[model samples]
Target: MTTPTRPPKTRRRPEWLVPAGLIALSLVPIVAGSARLTQLTTGAAVTAENARFFDSPVPVVTHIVGSSVFLVLGALQFAPSLRRRRWHRIAGRIVAPAGLLSALPALWMTVFYDIPTAVSGPGLAAVRLVLGTTMAAAILVAFIAIRRGDVRTHSAWMTRAYAIGLAAGTQVFVFLPYTLLAGTPSPVVYTLLMTAGWAVNLVIAEVAIRRRARGPRRRTGTTVTAAGARLS
Candidate 1:
C-alpha cells in the first residue's frame, strides 16, 4: 500500500494594492487640476511634434493599431468572465500578436520621444525601450506556453506581462501624490510618476504569477476519519 503524493508546494508572491488604489490615485488629477485629460496626455512620450514613422503614414497606423491593442488587452485584464472561462486560450491568439505589433511602434517611437519619465536625461529612451521590449517578450513566451497547454506557466507569465502593459495609466499616481503635497513643477513630478508606474507594474506582475501558481483550493468537507480522529 502506498500513500498518494501531493502536488509540489509553490512559493508565495506579494499582491499589488495599486488596483484598489487606482480610484484614489485617479482622483488626484481631477481634484487638483481642471485639465485632467490634458495632464494625462502630457505624461505620454508620444506627442504631435515627432509622430512620423517609415517616411509616410506610420504614425497614423501605429496610433490606430496600438491604441486598439492596448485598449482591448488592458480591458481583458480585469474581466471576470474572461478570467472565469479561462479564455486566455482564445484571447491569447489575438492579444499576443497585437502586443507584438504594439511593441515595435513603441520602440520605434522612442527615437523621436525625448521626454524624460522621472529620473531624467537620455536614460529615458533606454527606460522606454526596456519596458516595452520586456512586455513584448513576456507575452511571446506566455503565448508559447499556452499553445503547449502549460496552463500555470502561461497564466503566470501573461498576467505579469499584462501588468506592465497597463502601467501607462496607472503610473500617473506614483508621483501625483508628492506633486500635490509639494506643489512641485509639473515636469519634475510627471517624470517621477511615470518611472514609478513601470516599476510598480512589474511588481504587480510578479504578484499575479505568485497568486496564479497557488491556484484555487478545494473546499474541505467535514468527515469522520479512522483512529477516532476528526478530519475535515
Candidate 2:
C-alpha cells in the first residue's frame, strides 16, 4: 500500500547524459581504427601547427580547411535570421569552396584508415570506407547546389553534410557515460559511435527539416481554407 503523503518519483535523466552520449558515440576510435581517427580526435587539424604535430604528409591543409569551414556551416544552422537574411548566402559562398578543398585532402588520406581488428572479414572496413566516401560526395554536391541557386536542395544536402562534419564534435560528446557504464574499450567504442552517429544524425536532420517544411505548407492551406469560408 502506498502512502498518500508520498511524493511521486521523479524520472529525470541526468543533464550530463546528453554530452556523455555524444562523446561516447562520436569521439573514440575502434578496437583498432585507422591512425586517421586518432589524428582526428586530437584536434589534429584545428590549426596549421597541427601539421607539425602530426606525421609527415601532414593532414594539415585538410584539417585547417575542414575545421574552419565546418565552424561556419555549423553556426549558420543556429541563426534563422542570418539564414534568411542573405548573410547565409554570402557565408555559404565562402564556405563551400573551403569545404571542397578540405575534402580533397581528407579523401586522399583514406588509404591509411585501418580495418577493425578481430574482424577478419572485409565488411567492417568496407562499410567505413563507403560511408566516409558518401559523406564527402554529399558535401561536394551541397556545395554545387548553393552555386546553382537551388536553395532547397542546398539546404537539405548541406544539413546532411554538415551533420557529418559536426559528427566529430558530437562523437566526442557521446563517448562517456554509455562507455563508462557499458565498459567498452575506448577505440572500438569511438569508431562504432562515430559511424553509427553519422547515419543517425543524417536521418534526424532530414526528418526534422521535412517536418518544418511540411508545417508551413499545411498552415498556408489552412489559412486559404479559412479565407475561402469567410468569402462564402
Candidate 3:
C-alpha cells in the first residue's frame, strides 16, 4: 500500500501582532508622560512647556497615569487568545475605569487649564472637548452593553473608546513629517495634525469593528456548508 500523505497544517495568524503594534504606538506618549510624571513628583526644573502642568498638577497627573494604564492594559485586550480567556473580562474592568479617568480629566483640563493660545487655540479646544466627551461616553456605553449581555455592541464601543484614548500616541507620528519638513508647525497646523491623528484612529477602529462583526457570520456559513456536504 502507498503511504498516505497528511496535509500541511495551516499557520494561524499571530495573536500578538495587534497588541504589540498598539503598545509600540503607545510607547512614545508613554515615555513622554513618564518624564512629565517624574518631573512633577521630583520637582524637576520647570520650563514653559511643563509650567502649566506644575500650576495644576492633579488633572495632568491623573490624565498621564490613567491614560498610560488604559493604553498599555487596553492593548492586551485586543489579543485573540487573551480575549478567549478570563483575562479579557479582568482587563476590561480595569480598562473601562482607566479610560474614564483619562477622558474626564482631559476634558477638565481642556476647559479649565490656562493653556496658551499658541499651544491650544479655540479650534483645538473644541476638538478636545468633543473627543473627550465621546471617549467617556463610549466607555459608559460599552460598560452598559456588556452588562446587558450585548457582547458585540460592547466590543464595538470599547474599540472606539480605546482609539480616542490612543490618539495622543498617533498624534506624535502624524506631526513628525510636518515637523521635519517645516521645522516646528504653527498652531493651526498643529491643530490640523492632531485632528488627523484622531480621525485616522477612529477610522481604523470602525474598519476593525466591521471586520470582527463579519467574522462570525463567515465562520457560521462555512460550518453549515461543511455539515450539508457531510450529510449529503
Candidate 4:
C-alpha cells in the first residue's frame, strides 16, 4: 500500500490585505479631516491653528470631503474581486472626479491660503504645489489611458496618484518620531518630513507597479514551461 498523498499546498491570496491596510493608514487623516469639518460647520472655538480654515472654508471643505471619498472608495478599487466586477468601473467614475477635487483645491490652498512662514515656509508650500500638481496630472493621465484602452498605463498612473494622495496618511507616522523626540519641529523640519512621506509612498508605488507589470510575463513563462513538459 502507498502512503497517503499529501494535500496540495495552496498559496493564500491577499485580495483584501492591501485595501484594508490602505484604509487603516488613511484613518488618522480622515478622522482629523472630519474633526476640522465639524469645527467648520458647527462654529466651534476658532483657534490660530484653524483660523485660516474658517477664513477660507470652501477649499478646505472640498479637499477634506473629496479626499475622504477618494481615499476610502478608491482603496476598495484595489480589491481584485471588486475589479473583476462592474463595481470597479462605476467606482472609477466617482474616484477620478473625487481625486481631482481633492488635488486641485490643495493647489489652491497652497497658493492662496496665506499660511504663515513660521507654520509652513516657502519650501513646504513649493513641495505642496509640486505634489498636488503631480497627483492631479497622474489622475488625468490615468483617465486618458483608460479611455484609450491602455489598461496597464491607466493602472500605473492611478497607482501613482493614489500614492501621492495617501501621503497625508503616511505623514502621521513620519512626524510621530520627530514630535516625540524633538517636542516640536521647525518649518524646515516639517517640510523635510512631508517630503519624506511623499517620497516613500511614490517609491513604494513605483516598485509595486513594476512588479505588477512583470506578473503576466512570469505567468506566461510558467504556462509555456508546463506545456513543454507535457509535450516532452
* Candidate scoring better on TM-score of 1 and 3: 3
- State the lDDT of candidate 4 residue by residue for 1-232, as single tens digits: 9665443444766889999999999897799999999898899997777788999899999999899999999899999889879999999999999999999999999888878666674488889898899999999999999999998899999999999999999988999999999977887788898899999999999999998776533232133231223111
Q: Which of the two candidates, 2 or 3, achieves a greater TM-score against the reference?
A: 3
Model 3 C-alpha lDDT per residue in residues 119-174, reported as the tens digit of each score: 76449999999999999999999999999999999999999999999998899889
* 221: Cα error in model 1, Å: 6.0
Worst 10 residues of 4 by lDDT: 223-232
Give the per-residue Cα lDDT of candidate 2 at 10.
44
Instruction: Show model 3 residue runs off by greater than 4 Å.
Output: 1-11, 216-232
lDDT of 1 at 2: 71
List the pairs of residues colliding in candidate 1: 118-191
- Those runs of model 2 whose alpha carbons end farther than 4 Å from true positions after fitting are 1-53, 113-128, 186-190, 215-232
Candidates ranked by TM-score, best first? 4, 3, 1, 2
Least lDDT summed over 10 consecutive residues: which range in candidate 1?
A: 28-37
TM-score of each: 0.62, 0.61, 0.88, 0.89
lDDT of 3 at 193: 92
| Candidate with the larger lDDT of 1 and 4 | 4
